[model samples]
Target: MRTRTTLAAAGLLLTLTACGGDTDDKPSAPPSLTEEQRASARAAAGLPPEPSTTARYRFLEALNDIDRRIVDGKDGKDDKAVSRGLNQCRSIKNAAGDEDKQVALVQQTLSRFTIDTRLPDIATPETGGEILAAVHKNLCPDF
Candidate 1:
């Protein structure tokens, strides 16, 4: 009986560890992008020339900052910031009539992250490409 109890307790402990406890929290590392990768991604996407080196860095900084915030559970702030940034990007594409390539590139990049669509009032990218396509459609339907 004691042996059976010990085995059962061990099994329970293993199950709990595998199940990740009652909380859904999982640890994750911060998101980052290298300068070369950023430049390559922008070039592949046919982005407009950077206003300046500072401007280019600012754009990437903003993206990483928001990504970290989202991962840290700052959902409301993240949503608002991402929405604004995406809208601005869309506006630029619309004005330049260069939406398609940008959308495709963004879709490719966004695929690196896990999208959560179950949240309230959120229309997350099912794939990185989908979000980019949607943004293009919304901002520059002509493209």
Candidate 2:
């Protein structure tokens, strides 16, 4: 069982950390939303909340173990990669235990994580399904 206080604290830290780095003259991109907002949106969509900050880092570390591309460059602080992984969790939660749904989400999201890196693409549903399993275990376990 988890506590609301813990979740709120983690959300605060995530927002704080995610707020760092220069935004001045930063190229326009999708507007950023805080972790709490993201989580609320996920919940509104009928998905489960993401893990704590510690768990998220652990999740990234586990994915890094599976393939370098997942965390290539930026030394695991790659915001895009991390978001991509968390988005996987959202879809995976919605997927429930349906193997095909999970596999398809992997196909859609996994390639984006791997492409453009020096490493070969980790896009295959077979491999992606395995990697997404790590996301499930660390961040969004069965509920």
Candidate 3:
């Protein structure tokens, strides 16, 4: 997961640089960072890699698109959201399809985000339910 995210960042940089450079001197080839090197690079940037497949990445992207008062799209905070999201998925799976348990798990997980929702502090249960629905539809359809 971390590798993929780091690669994404690095890939974007490589693509941008490769797109256009000095018209005089040829652009130098980009160095491919090893796993440890990539991990260090990601750590330096403080961005968490997307978890699981491209589906989960898209899910989080869509989730962040909402005004859910979360900072998952930010640099330092995205990792926490990814970690909490993956954790919630595992917890929901462990709940064995119990709706109440799943809802509660999501509510608990919501505390992990830096939210600025309609509520004063915590997000509404309805919001949590919506998040859970997205999770089910996106991350854990089997659950």
Candidate 4:
């Protein structure tokens, strides 16, 4: 009986740990990028040539990744599906109302598509751009 109880406790601990309770609440700073990398991402997103701050650069990088994945034909082209998820994500970010919170929300939102098995179809580049736009419309419409 003691052994069984010990095993049960161990299993419970393992399950809780696997639930990702250790996730950081703080968002990490975006990585620094070379001018070429920034330019490439900007070009991919059709932005004008100019210096981009960390937030803009990270957003562009995320957009570029989606665009690249779409061109590579890795996912389906269901814009509506992507739009729905992105809209929800955008709402979450808007409610957060701070740059760090928004960044955290975006990271969490995007990570769900990759990590959550039961999530709906992944977003393609076009869909990803649309999703970004949805969020940016509220957060940085001029960006």
Q: Give the top-scoring candidate (TM-score).
A: 2
Global lDDT of each candidate: 0.48, 0.69, 0.61, 0.49
Tens-digit lDDT track of model 4 for 1-143: 99999999999999988877556667789999998998688556544344235544444455445544422333543333344334444445355557766555544544544422332356334453454454464324443
- After superposing candidate 2 on the true structure, give the runs of residues whose Cα lies further than 4 Å from its correct spot: 1-39, 75-77, 115-118
Ranking by TM-score: 2, 3, 4, 1
Question: Candidate 2, residues 5-51: lDDT per residue as tens digits?
Answer: 89999999999999889768667799899988997898887556756
The regions of model 4 sitting more than 4 angstroms off are 1-66, 70-76, 112-143
Candidate 1 residue 11 Cα shift, in angstroms, is 79
The local lDDT score (0 to 100) that residue 55 gets in candidate 2 is: 77
Candidate 3 per-residue lDDT, tens place, 38-116, comes to: 7576445443333467766766765665544564355756566556565566666667767677657656655544342
Question: Which residue runs of candidate 3 sit more than 4 Å off their true CA positions?
Answer: 1-53, 114-122
Residue 119 of candidate 1: its Cα lDDT?
Answer: 27
The TM-score measured for candidate 4 stands at: 0.27
Candidate 3: Cα lDDT at 31: 90
Q: So what's the TM-score on candidate 1?
A: 0.25
On residues 1-143, what C-alpha lDDT tens digit does candidate 1 reach at each position? 99999999999999988987557677788778788777677556644323344543344354454344333346465445344434445344544645675555543435333334322223244444444444344433443
Q: How much does candidate 3 score in TM-score?
A: 0.50
TM-score preference between candidates 1 and 2, better one = 2
Instruction: Give the clashing residue pairs of candidate 3, or none.
Output: none
Residue pairs clashing in model 1 are 107-128
Q: Compute the lDDT of residue 29 as modeled in candidate 3.
A: 97
